[model samples]
Target: MLLVKILKFNSALLTFLLFTSPIQANEFWGLESWMNSLKTPDFTKIKDVNQRKQAFFEYLLPEINKQNEKIVQLRHALKTDNINSFKLQKIYNRYRVKEGDIDTLLMRVDIIPASLILAQGAYESNWGRSRFAKYYHNFFGLWCFEKGCGIVPLKRDKAATHEVAKFSSLDKSVEYYMRSINRNSAYATLRKIRKNKRDKQAHITGLALAEGLENYAEIGYEYVETVQSIIRYNKLSQYDYKS
Candidate 1:
């Protein structure tokens, strides 16, 4: 009886591994070279508004997909019992969760839907034409506090210490933006919405998650409404999971 149960457990583990490995492998296959060759296009040079918007989205989609793919891989790793202890510890530290607390790590390590990312990027950066976006690759309007850390806002009060955060590349900006959304207390509601959607097997739409971002801007709920409006007007939902 013991031998039979052991064989069954082994078979189930093998089946699980077989089912998941291919999907994760395909997500990463051939992506590194393509990502390496990518360059940020000069969206500011496009005169037509429609053409510029199209160019901006095109430039951003691949990097967004790449970042989401990495998040998905991390989530998958966390679900397995045999995950490397070193890698798991790194994930816990990176997400600022207690070590061995897989539930919180899972919530913090998940993907931000492409639609939300795109809408926020467009709304914040004026469709990639803002000085921060053009000069610093900071499409999400992230701020940094250390002196000389980033560009100071022209309109910032003399007493204000925060400066708009700069990034070495658009990818870095997206990475930090996603990390902020996942780990920040301000977006705890957003993470809850995402986790609820996952539990229900629902398509995690940007419009739905946008509701949790009322505090993202000083304008409160108005900011959430504007983000949702951007998603609707631009049809950014098409980039998100359909089912």
Candidate 2:
């Protein structure tokens, strides 16, 4: 009887391990681990423009989906006024990227790295601490002059000091950000590059997208360089993939 009991205990332990091992493996990899597996492009070594473009788009899609889902959940939590949910959702919404707009942008232009975009949003909004970001859901630091759309900041400047835009909710803010990039003439170069990538069935690269936003910063050309530096130094673009 004692021998039989020992055999039964061993069988149960083996069954438990069998059921739990796969789950453990999946959890071990996680999202960050999967993202790290993507091949990093050595700009110096990769001379083929077409190949580079293709790689950029492929890498960007998964990251875009991840950020978009977070924004969606965050918007839902805010609308419901669930404070606990809001706290959790805030992390995702803090660096939002619109899904539909990204798809449209990619369809019309080349792919942009989702991580780079999110990093820019985080920086612009000061990690969601900026007045516009906290009160208006303006995650991208976009300024609006028109009435009925945004609020005017207390401090006014010649360029955009008084011109802060507001949103009714997080979704609207994300929508506006997408529209700003897609419709604005300044981003036309970006749109065109996207179109070319789509035509050739290629991926988007953060390096390429940086070129289109030559005017994104107050510092002119230097702003573009800064974003690139952030992406490279921190390896931010590596997050633009799935696990």
Candidate 3:
């Protein structure tokens, strides 16, 4: 009788594993498929400036929209339901918020506008023709501190220890970019601007938030102006309407 019980338990466990493993595999394959969708194109070969800009937008906008949709879902989850402590802690860690600081987590997990993402990507990667964008898939100029973690900047300061971060896919780069914008101290002003807009129930335009990005480049306000100029020039605000 004891032997028969043990055999039945083993059989049940085997059956459970057989049933669950394909679902796990399919989840992984689905993620792989999503990553595969964000293919990079050789923007440098496009001779016309207008054509290059259009191509760049077309390449990035879909991935950007997907990322924003994810954030919206996460934000909704946090607002509407009680998530498990482990999952809530993961959100806090991802946004660098203090544990139990639900308010800050909510603030930091919001979506960045697609227009702002496009403008920043266009400027930083030179419409995807930059060496870092081509080789490393690093569009937002993020840095990693560990050695061998990323590509060393050719023009890095002699004492600087940071290297530009590399990504396996453009969508991952966009994910990190949005997270950085949400959590990094340098972009606190931008967050505040976004929060205020949210409070007022106003349209969150890329042009409005660009005002807070004074520290994004060494030129301060000039950088903000340049980003706003790009948004205006390309009619990027049109994308922000749905953001």
Candidate 4:
């Protein structure tokens, strides 16, 4: 009976591993290997637009899904019945800076569409081949004024001290990217558009929401247009579905 009990425990452990690994270990090769695979030009040069879009989405979908899981878990922690629990209060305290109040924060916790972020990241990082992405995993061109925030841009204006933000890991960069769009005043229009879409539909498409990013870059409307064009030309809207 002892041998049988040990066998049962091993079976249960295997089941648990299968269930948990997909969510936590989506990178089949490991983080650095996964990052290197995305930087390969072979995936970027796929002639078919949908094929190329799929390649990019495949590289990022696991990371995006993981961040959204954390956001959802935090939002669930604030549920009316759970808000006062010690576990939830800890979560709330951690995210209080990113989310001002629970209600307002829930509105911002939703995921940005894979297609929209993909287009923007591709534009910013040159398909992960940019020097910034190479050195810093700074795919979004996000800036921080803190003295040691990240890499200092060579062409930063003589009077400007903003450093391009660096991330310790690629997923950390993606997490910060989503949070910046969600909470930053500069992307209020995008968040508003996203909130409205969430109210109307169970799932929001990236193409519909790209309009609200009109001010995302120095080029303003032109940048929004370029993102939309990338989405349109690449048929990236197909990847907007979460499941």
Q: Is candidate 2 or candidate 4 better by lDDT?
A: 4
lDDT at position 134, candidate 1: 76
**lDDT, candidates in the order shown:** 0.83, 0.54, 0.82, 0.71
Model 2 misplacement above 4 A: 1-112, 158-162, 241-243
Instruction: Give the per-residue lDDT of model 2 (tens digit) for 1-243.
Output: 985686576557546765777656434333223222222233234457556444543433454554555544544554465547445444333334343343442332222466557556556764444656555556577876576445676666657534677554454555556546655677777777756655676665666677777767678778677777766765667665322
lDDT of 4 by residue, 122-237 (tens): 88987665766655666788899988767788888989989998664668789889887876767778877877876777567787778878778888889988999988987777
- Model number with the top lDDT: 1
Between prediction 3 and prediction 4, the one with superior lDDT is 3
**Could you give candidate 1's per-residue lDDT for residues 1-243 as a string of tens digits?**
985686576557646766766645433322322232234566778999889888988989899999998888777777876588887788788889999788888889888888999999999999988988876788998999998778899999989999999776778889999999999999999999999999999888899999889888999999999999999999999998543
TM-scores for all candidates: the values are 0.82, 0.51, 0.82, 0.72
Worst 10 residues of 2 by lDDT: 31-40
Comparing candidate 2 with candidate 3, which one achieves the higher TM-score?
3
As a whole number from 0 to 100, the lDDT of residue 224 in candidate 4 is: 86
Clashing residue pairs, candidate 1? none
Model 4 ranges off by over 4 Å:
1-55, 83-100
